[model samples]
Target chain A: MNESLRNIWTILKRELTGYFASPVAYVFIVIFLLLNGFFTFMLGGFFELGEASLSRPFFNWHPWLYLFLVPAAGMRLWAEERRVGTLELLLTMPVTAAQAIIGKFLACWAFLALALALTFPVVGSVYYLGHPDGGAIFAGYVGSLLLAGSYLAVTVATSAITRNQVISFILSVVICFFLILAGWEPVTSLMVRWAPAGLVELVTGFSVMPHFASFQRGVIDFRDLLFFASVIVFSLFGTSVILRGLRGA
Target chain B: MIDVENLIKEFGPKRAVNGVSFTIRRGEILGFLGPNGAGKSTTMRMITGFFPPTSGRVRIGGHDIAEEPIAAKKLIGYLPESAPCYSDMTVNGFLRFTAELRGMRGAQIDAAVAKVAGLCFLEGVLHQSVDTLSKGYRHRTCFAQSILHDPEVLVLDEPTDGLDPNQKHEVRQIIKRMGQTKAIIFSTHILEEVEACCSRAIIIDRGTVVANGTPAELKARAETAGSVHLRVRNVAAETLKSKLGSLPVAGRVSLQDNPDGSLSARVFPRDKSTRADLSLSVAQTATQSGWSFDELHTEEGRLDDVFRAITLPDSVKNRE
Candidate 1:
């Protein structure tokens, strides 16, 4: 409905404003850029890879980098409202739970996009120094956006469970780490050996790395896009349910 | 108009609101008077559709709160207890966000924000972040947000809790003015506020409506057996005492010595009597005794006594 969209926009606008008004957004962006840049240049050894593309270093460490930074960004999404007692005011308004969830998620995603956009200089540096596939770089950015969105969804759900921001951050990190680890060969092979075949495949498919991997390869498969979209939608739906249950309580 | 029918809210094993029912006609200022933890806030939350009742229903402007919450909530402007607000946003930003959330567009949002700011006296602090404002300013900002929507019904919980005496009076005036057109329900523990602002009151204790009536009606119930205080001058103490002792209306009369040539006597009636009858009888007696009456006043019962009597069990349990 038009009213629902308006409500969601209002929530998103306020949340975005809240982020910019505080130093938290800027601090998170600086840290994200600094850490990602450091890992790409120093640890991953961009020159050692001897590749024109940033795919070897830039796209490789995104999942791990987001494992920490996304939680830091999303921990206060709902936790701060609960801590300050503003959740009651928000819920009492003429808006539905779904609108609030989507609105908050979009706000967090937009902020993450801003942080991602700040890495333009790195993109420029890669282009100036050596020839790279523009399509792959575009796919890499899309994959990073999807990964951030998926992590934000998980963090939003975690934040709804408690008023303590630290606990929300820790819980989100643990969950996201598990999802990331499931996509790696070492974990999937171990799961395949012990677990049922369907369960192992399901777990691996649910992992962020595989879907992200497909995108990083410049392959925009419908299945991989659907996987990320499903995660975002499912987690936001779960957050709405949790919030509704809290209000009922 | 607002109607609540036998509303009940249970938290796990405990009932927060129990079979509470009330209605607010258009343009009625109903006061919810109760001690802390007496289900006032819970009832308000249900009416606002913030929380669903375990059973029963709340209807606002023909919309059921549980079934059609958005429509029901659109009719309500609520100022919750302690005035919770976004501390990081400026007052202007918060109000503007609230206006937009209420579906105000373009210049309409700005005008609504300006109107509420003016009404709540928040213009000076419009640019200040909510965290930087004082408690009074924070409360005003919250009030502004609630009224910005121009809802038909207003529910305010402890709206004047942290305000000073002057601020409380000013807020009361605003509420009084608003009540002229809107159906307003506000909760308070202060009995004097009820006497000053409320047209009708519902007194709850232990999640039950112990009393519901106009202020004078509640006071009258408390004073079913009335008492009077009389001060007599220009008459001997013995003469005044004998005259008081002979009156059939005086159930119990006690005399005290005054520094001036006057006697202070407290008279209790055997039956409930109006203040007019008591004054007339006392005046006739003073004239008959040739004693000039210095002071004659009727004592009205206080709501505090009723509250103490009703909530004694809860108070005892809390203490233990």
Candidate 2:
């Protein structure tokens, strides 16, 4: 168990350092912060909600924002290794596949947290202006994190399938978009109208909306947490399988 | 110690390594000599556990590569061809990461990194990013990473492929020193490198082992079908040709006119014969006819000749 933790730490440290050592992480943080702020205030019309709270404005656009920006952060996690022939070196190292996948995913997730943290001004502004439910604000951030983690997990799995960064990014975004849209009321209603009742329920359960909705409402449900955790675990497991197949090949 | 038994690797219909097997004892430097596409890299990859063989098994230090890959890999240090490394990391950072991945911690990691850095002459470039370094320095950094953990078995594929002559010499010297305590398997297309560095060589061609022996043994095999080149002066071409033709050792003698009024004759011997007998016959003829023997030297067969002779298409088909 100690050795496994050490391996995780080693992979995490190397991945985080790789991010900061290059211009990629900084560029991602700056672009994500700028876009999030721009869409929340100017485009999302936070004042129109009229509650002097960022709950609606900030949390409303996070799904769409992560749909694009998260791929940028997560696309190179495994794809670049395959591209540069370093995947062989990494896989042949004395670490379990799960350790490598988790370590890399957590490092990128930490970068996302850093980017979210820089949006503190938005939270601070909401606090400074008027009365708002602090619990809701906290829950909103949790939901965003879970949502980001889920997307990154999927992206990491897709990245492991190919060496081309562009293809990984595009495929991840499309897949995440589908998952997000599948949970939207209009899409689920349409599926319910046309498809069998059981299939509609399954599709709705698979989407990010129902689970994210609980967190958005300032409630941390066990089922919702399990939903996100299971997604992360299952996707990483798939990534490991793909990598093992590559090594076997 | 390393043992590969009946290892086979196939890519679709193309057989990359076919029932290939070999063994390397401790403290021996075995050179894997072959041309391009001769399955040398494929075989090394299998032994290093980067890829599993389609069949058979590899045992490194008594640990089966397939059954106990981590244990086997722990005993081996591998440097793949072209020495690919991360370009973003500094030399020190890369080495440290590699050491950590190999399960070293704290002072052990530091000491291992320092030892390898010094061994590969990477002290000056330790802080510099790998992308900014020259090719020789990059190769050295990769070399340093490979030996950072001091494994008992070392596999280097084309270790000196891109270095200049001076750099090649330096790397060869380092390898020779390291071979004292480790079993080293290095592959290269340069036969001169084998002659200079390897105690034994395994020559492969067309995805199969063609010959395996010491450099001297291979040279001796080539000498059995040797040809001689001679330069004689002041002798009529017909007389010299007839004299060489009459010798028992000379199978086929052909004379050519030289620019300096000397006649050069090439003598093919049916069996392995020393140059003394051919020299004696030419010397006797020159002494009796007042001719001059400018040059009478026995041709020593080289590794290149052996490689060419053994890997020829006709010879390969005949071996089957």
Candidate 3:
């Protein structure tokens, strides 16, 4: 491997293992599975709807599910390093700031992917009840992973702004919640009163739901993939900018 | 080699390090001394490329820090103040991580880690978590990481701050041993440390270099450089003070308590006295006066006194 590639891999491997060394990995996986099962079966009315489709009962709940879990996973990423003063030690190494950011974000993304994978039983049950759309289920997993990446990126950037994990978590959730509300019908309709049509469209265009809606029925679009990729790239850039802005602070 | 020129660091309107410059050649151990907030750690941070200087430049082995930070940083092994490490990691794990970051790989990483761990005496705590180690062990663990890649330059900030006496001695020995091939700079408030290991010392006060020279040169800069101390059994301090006061070799005689029920007097030379032979005169006078002498010796001037004068000149001048 290239040296920088090796370094990033080393950091990613350590960070991923670090999550498991603590109870964080098990706790996050168990809670995520439980929440997905409860909300899918009880709230989404899978029985009453009598549909074998997992979209409404399982995959549809990802945005809200990630709203809480992504920030929880990312809150400590930078905040804990700053608070403990290890940020200085880490930065002084041969690694570049961008490399550190990429390495850590990849770790959290991989951990969230692990949590997402553990929900495979949902797909199994949906298949048992009725012949579910296999392509749709796979696409749902893909879209859901992209959604988790966007949330994690935002949380990682927010965590870089402060040294308090609680503050980082709250700041990320508030920012992410605003992003979620941008395309919600009630909020956009209320905004349609005073807002220009073009501006409202642009605002909602950045929302996760509009982009995430395509993969609900196994439809894969380049635009939705671009949106998630842009979110990840923009947020990672913001994280590095915030880190540079606070140098010698 | 480590070269720093006109380094200035500004935090808002306050200048933490103002236009400081110095150089350290290989085989030299430079001791950085100052009072609290004198910018010792700030200077070290800049040297290690942890913090960019507001102005000026640092060049490690001819590579400019700002222009070529990675190249400069690759040559530096730094131990920041408080010895910050990943507390959750075992000593062995942290060492391996640092070694890999320093570009060591495969069997080289393992060999390098073992070399530094053994040199720092961290073999005993290799399996222990960093947070579980005592202050001394934690300090050595950090020291081990800094040397894992065997960088050409080492910057240590208060490496022995909270260690016990034995630990301090051991750390000093390690630094002395390393000084032969590595250009090293370490900061400390402990004056005796300069004497223990440093080949040269720099005293920084209010973000400026007040004095920079060999350790002995700094001690000689003290105003009482050639003073001699005499502990007499039965002579009155007044009599010795008058007699020593009149001697041409002696300038002023001040009495000090020896804590052993003996009257101790310090004799200062008249002028430019660092190289003067005042002890010979004091001993001759003691023999002629028939005063029973318990102890008599010439003082080389205490580094603490010199440190106080250089780093805290305002208070020292006010007291005088």
Candidate 4:
């Protein structure tokens, strides 16, 4: 167990440093921050809402923002390794494939978390403007991070499907797009107009919106947490299977 | 130690490696030689635990690779064919990462990285990112990573493929020195490298072992082995051929006219295994004929000839 942790930590450190070694990290952080500021202040109309809560303005844009950014950040997770032929070097080391996958996922997730954390000034802004439920704000942050994790995990699986990063990125975005539109209010209403009610509910059950919305309302329901955890676990597990199949082939 | 037993790998309907087997004890260097697509890389990958054999087992230091991959891999240092490294990392960082993955502590990681860097002559580029390094430097950086752990078994695939002549010599020297203590297997298309460093060599063709022997033994299988070549002045081609061919020790005598008007004759032994008496008999014949000769020597045979004889298509081999 201790050896496994050490292995995971070693891979994590290397992967995390890999992000910082190139200009990708800085550019990603800058674009992420700028986009968040733009959506929250200019488009979402945080001032017009006249509410102390960040659910509408800041947290609401997270799912869409991550739809693009998370895939971009995670596309290189396995694709670059395969393209550069480092996958052999990595797997031949004295570490399990699971350790390498988790380590890489956590590193990219932590980078996303850092970018999300950089939005702290907005949290401060809400606190300054009016009294707000700190628990609710914290819940929103957790939900946002989970949403990003789900997208990033899906990206990780797609990254292993091809050695080309662009293909991985496009695949992740298309998959996440369906996850978002499935439970989206307008899409559900459109489905209700022509489809059976059970089918609509069943499809929306796969959507991430309802789960993320509950977190924004400060309800840390176990079901919602389970939904996000399962997404991460399932996709990472798929990544490992795909990697093994590639080696086997 | 490295032990590969009846390893077989199939991708769909195509068998990449077919029931290939070999064992290397400590302090032995086994050179893997083969033509293109002969499964050398596939065999090395299986031994290093990168690819699980479809059937069979690879044991490293008594641990079965398929059953205990982590433990088995811990005992191996592999330099893959492409010599891959993380281009995003500096040489020092890359080596440090590999050392840490090998379970070294902080100071130990630093020391190991430094040791391999010096050994691979990577100190100059240790601070440079991998993408910026030359092909040879990149190859050495990956080679350094393989030896960072000082593994009990070392598998190198074309370790000197991209190296200049001097760098190739240096890498061969390193492999020779390390082979004194570790079980080592390296594959190459260059037959001279096998003669230069390998204690034993296995040549594979079409996914199977075709020949396994020492450099000298394999060379002795060449068609020219145990043949004598004589260049003499004032001897007619027909006269030399008939006289040399008539000798009881000689099998076939072929003559060529040199541009300088001297006759060059090669005498094959009646029995290919006997090389000692062929040269002496040719020398005696020349002296008796009162023919002055500029060159008279026995051919030790050549590795390339043997390699081609076994690997080339049957029609091509017959034509040669």
Candidate 5:
């Protein structure tokens, strides 16, 4: 493998193992599964709907679910390194800045991907009860992952800006909360007149729920994929910039 | 070899390292000596390519650190002051990870890990998590990681800080051993450590190099260097001063009364080059006069004295 890719893999290996070694991993995975189950069955009324569709119960709530869950995982991404002073150790190594950021960010994304995979039972239930649309379900999983990617990027970027994980978590949640809010129809419709048309369109287009809504219905639009990819790229780039600034500071 | 030329680091309005420059060759242990916040850490950081120098160049072998950091950093093994590492990792695991990061793998990684672990006396704690280890072991683990790949240049920031006497002695011994092959620089404010392990020492104050030379050369700069200390019995202070003053020695001779009713006198030489045989002459004088003496010796001076004199503020120095 090339040097950059090798460095990324090394960081990823450490981070993933770090999660499993700590109590936080068990806590996060358990809470993630429990809350996912509760929201899908009790709140979203999967049984009352009595349909094979996992959209309303599963994919529909991914944006809201990831708003809090993704940051919980991503808060420690850079904040822990800063608090423990390993950022200096890492930056001093032969690895470049991009490798460190991508390695760490991808590790958290992979952990979230594992957490999402645990929800396979939901898919099983939908399949057993009725012959559900595998194509749509696959698309939903892809979109849900893309949604989680966007949120993780936000958390990692914010975490890089500060040493305190609490501040990193809170800042990420607040930013995510607004981004999701812009997608909700009622809130945006009311503000459409008061807000400028272009500003409204930009917020609406950038909002997580709207971009994710198409995937919730298994549409697989290129525009939505583009949105999520752009967010991830821009946030990781910002993390590198912030890290460089800290070194000089 | 490591060469730093005109290295400067400015943190906002404050200059942390100012126009510092030095060169270190293989088998030479360079002691970086300074007080707290005196830019020793900052200078080391720039040399290791951890932080870029604002307006200078650091060349490791032939590669410039800023222009080719990856190539330069590959030749370095750095242990930052606190010895930072993943607290969650086992000692073996962290060492393996660091070895791999430096491009070691498989049996080579294991061999390097075992070598440094043994050299650093970390064999006992290899299985334990880093957070669970004692401060001494945590420090040793970091030291071991630095030497895992055995890079050409070793930069350690206060490698012996917070270690017990035994641990400090062991660490010094390892640095001395490694000094045979690597261009090593270890920073410390402990005056004796420079004399203990370093062949050449650089003393910095307020971001600038104040004195740089061999330990002997620096010690020679002290006011007490090459002075004669004579302890005599059955002699009054006035008699001893008048007698010693009559000698060919052309500087002040002061006497202090000792607790045993003997007189202790310190004699300065006429010039910076005090004769190495001054103590012999003083002994001859005491014997010829039949004056019994407790002790007589020539002082080579201590690095402690040299460090204080060289690093002291100009105002305080001038007042004395």
Candidate 6:
């Protein structure tokens, strides 16, 4: 078990270093921050809302924001390896495919976490302007990070399915878009007209919206945390299966 | 240190590798030879544990690759066919990353990386990013990663494929030197490379081992093996053919018209395994007939002939 963790750490370090070694990491970070700023200040109406809480203005936008950015950050994880033929090099090593999958997923998640943490100035502004609930802000950050992880994990699985990065990116975006739209109020209301109420509830239960909303409400519900954790674990498991299928083929 | 038995790999409806098997002991360099899509790379992938066999087994240093992949993998170092490395990293960083994955730590990773860099002649570009390096350097960097752990078994798929003549020679020398200690298997389309370094060679055709032997043994399978060639300046083509063909030891004779109006006669030995030298018999026949010859030698056969003869028959088979 210790050896397995060490191998995961080794793969994680290499992937994280790979991100920083090129212009992609810096470029992605800049774009993420710029988009976050634009969404929060202009479209999200942070100033128009005139509230100390970041729940409505800040955290609410993450499910949509991560739909594209997280896929962009994670699409190259396995796709580039397959394209460059390094997938053979990586899997033939002493490390197991599961370890490599987890390591790469964590590296991208950590980078997303870093990009999320860089938004501290917005949190500081909330504090400077008024007395904001620190607990709720912390929960919002946690929720946002989990949202990115869920999207990234799905991207990782899609990335493992193809060698072309564009195809992987498009596939991930489509899947994650469904994850968001299934429970988005506008889309769910559209489904409620023809669909049975239980079916509508079942489909909405699959989306990340309500679970992410709980954190925004300053409630650390175990069920909500379970939803996010299961998303990550299930998607990473799918990635492992895809990797094994690639080898077998 | 490497044993493969009845290894079968099927991709959907296609059987890429079918019951292919071979074993390599320590200090033996086994050359894998085949036409394109003849399952050379697929077999190498299985031996390196990249792909599990559909029905057989690969044991590296007595550890079953299917069951104890990490242990078997730890005993083997593989340089994949395309020779891939992370282009985002410096050569030094890439080597270090590979070393760490191989279970090295702290100062050991640095030393192993430096050692392999020197061995693969990558010292000059250790700090340069892999993407900026030329093909030869990038290939060597990947080769360096394979040897960094100094494993007992090494699988290199076309190690000298993209190298220039000089680099090819250097890489061959390295393989020859390393083959004295480690069990090595390398695939190449270059026939001369097999003759240069392989202790033994396997020629697979259509997912089967068509021929397997030492360089000399395989060459002996050629139709030209033990044939004698005699070139004479003043002799008529008919006379030379008749004289050489009449010899008791000669099976058949053919004459070629040289540009200089000289006769070039090739005499086949009646028996390839005969201890008598066909060249000597031809020399004696020349003296008896008063025919002066310019060049006379016995053919030892050629690997190129054997490779083509064994592999080209199935050209009609569909290629992927």
Best candidate, DockQ: 4
TM-score of candidate 2 on Cα atoms, chains taken together: 0.93
Error of 4 at A215 (Å): 0.6
> Looking at candidate 1, what is the lDDT of residue B153?
95
lDDT of 6 by residue, A16-117 (tens): 999998889999999988988888889889888988999988888899889999999999999999999999999999999999999999999999999999
Say which docking band candidate 3 falls in: medium
Q: Each prediction's DockQ?
A: 0.78, 0.61, 0.64, 0.82, 0.72, 0.78
Model 5 Cα lDDT, one tens digit per residue, B139-241: 8898888888888999999999888999999999989989999899999989889998999999999999999999999988888888889988887788778
lDDT tens digits by residue: candidate 5, A18-76:
99999988899899999999999999898898889989887877888888989999998
Q: Which ten residues in a row are the worst by lDDT in model 6 chain B?
A: B311-320
- Superposed on the true interface residues, model 5 gives a C-alpha RMSD in angstroms of 1.4
All candidates: TM-score:
0.94, 0.93, 0.96, 0.98, 0.97, 0.97
Q: Model 1 off-target regions past 4 Å?
A: A192-196, B223-225, B233-242, B254-263, B273-276, B314-320
lDDT of 4 by residue, B196-296 (tens): 99999999998899999999999999999889999998977788888999999999888888899988998999984556788998899899989899999
Residue A145 local lDDT, model 2: 94
**Could you give candidate 1's per-residue lDDT for residues A16-101 as a string of tens digits?**
98999999888899999999899999988987887878777898899999999999999999999999988888988888888998
Clashes of 1: 0
Candidate 2: list runs displaced more than 4 Å.
B223-226, B256-259, B272-291, B312-320
**B41-137 per-residue lDDT for model 2 (tens digits):** 9999999988889998999999998898778888888888878788889999999998988988789988998888887788999999998999889
**Superposed Cα deviation of residue B196, candidate 4 (Å):** 0.6
**How should the candidates be ordered by TM-score, best one leading?**
4, 5, 6, 3, 1, 2
Q: In candidate 5, how many Å is residue A219 off?
A: 1.6
Error of 5 at A196 (Å): 3.5
Q: Please, what are the lDDT tens digits per residue for candidate 6 over residues B69-103?
A: 99999999999999999999999989998998999
